[model samples]
Target: MDIIPQIRAAMHTLLSTTTEAIAAAQQYVKRPDRAKFTPSTLVQTLVYGWLAQPTATVEQLAQMACRIGVDVSPQAIDQRFTLATADLLRQLVLASIQPVIAANPVALPILQRFASVRVHDSTSIGLPDALTSTWRGCGNATTGGGSTLKCGVQLDVLTGTITALVPTITGWN
Candidate 1:
């Protein structure tokens, strides 16, 4: 069928299943009375490489969702980013995908065989000034007032699917 329909169906299937990580992450989400991006849906977003994009903004993410027939606004998705609830979901998505990656199914590999999931890979997800102060002026050359921006990770340990994603961090000391 058309790409939108196909993507929509895939999104459905991705979020439809349940697992321990999903449950825990969901509880993590609701506990803070956060904005709406169910843990399952967040897991799907992270799993599908949506959040993995170095320069993917909420607007871009929402557009990606719309490509799959999801009509939510970028503003809404951007708001969800603050919850920090998605971090756990990111880990869960990585863990869940580890098996598919390891199998190297030659069909739909979630991660390439033996790829380095952790590295200095990121771009501007959104504009500099509009983001939170912490998100602005990154690395050692950053503006003094804000905290550093974060880059994300996706690792496949003896993989089938993604097994872990460390978080959008400022790298090591």
Candidate 2:
């Protein structure tokens, strides 16, 4: 089935609203010294690139931005992907979830038997020794002796949306 039209429609509906909410939140203050791209533009570009190609590289993202009339270097684009960027993207994802579910309801016959279906998974990433104090490691048992960051995500299978995402130090649990 053709999905491009649907994707475009969803983007049209959500992008501006999400961008406005993000701007109002003031999550990322624009620094006068380095204000090449607005949060909205960066968010839109990243979303588009991800949707178009999940494994797109920083260079590809930079090219995509250029195609859309924004001249930016791959390094600049990469630098923009900080913890703050992740938080902002997560917020945007959470915000668009309801609308996404509403637009694309689950129709699989096998899934109809359940009132709700959810899935959960976690991933751990090893961090540098410097981050040990900030994000405690899992000790000698897991990551040898370095800090580790673990993140868990709960997905609503029926709606094909993420219900929650929790990030914590590996030593927490």
Candidate 3:
């Protein structure tokens, strides 16, 4: 099946909703004066690229930015994945859900069995010693020098969308 149209439709829906969220949150005020990439542009470009190619790399993201007239380097694009960016993305994700659900209500009999279907999972990753101060990883029993980053995600099964992403340097909750 051709996926281009589906991707385009999804992108349009997400971008419009994210644009509205960015405006309401006044997210651009946090950026520096000479910032070339607005929060809306960055979110749109990253989401579109990921939707088009799930395994897309930073180089590919940079190319996508270029196509959208951003002209940013791969390093810059990678660096943009900071905590603030993650928070912005999370806000946009939450903001998009209401609109999507309102526009396309789920009426499948199988899905209607539950009030809400949420899937939760968590993972832990080892991090460099330097990030211990910033990220505050759990103390290692063997190698106390290293740190661990734990991330948890909650997805809405009916909508096939991520409802929450919780990142912590501490142990999983």
Considering every candidate listed, which one attains the maximal lDDT? 2
Query: Which digits, one per residue and each the tens of the lDDT, describe model 1 over residues 85-135?
Result: 445555555544433333332333554554544322443233345444444
lDDT of 1: 0.49
Give the alpha carbon lDDT tens digit for every residue of 42-94 in model 3: 88679878988987999999888888888999898888877677667766765
In candidate 3, position 18 carries an lDDT of 57
Greater-lDDT candidate between 1 and 2: 2
Given candidate 1, what's the lDDT at residue 106? 33
Tell me each candidate's TM-score: 0.41, 0.57, 0.53
Worst 10 residues of 3 by lDDT: 97-106
State the C-alpha lDDT per candidate: 0.49, 0.74, 0.70
The CA lDDT at 60 in model 2 is: 89
TM-score of 1: 0.41
Q: Output candidate 2 Cα RMSD.
A: 5.6
Q: Which residues of candidate 3, in runs, are more than 4 Å off?
A: 1-13, 23-29, 102-173
Query: Once superposed on the true structure, which residue ranges of model 1 sit more than 4 Å away at CA?
Result: 1-26, 29-36, 45-54, 103-173
In model 2, what lDDT does residue 106 have? 70
Number of backbone collisions per candidate: 16, 0, 0
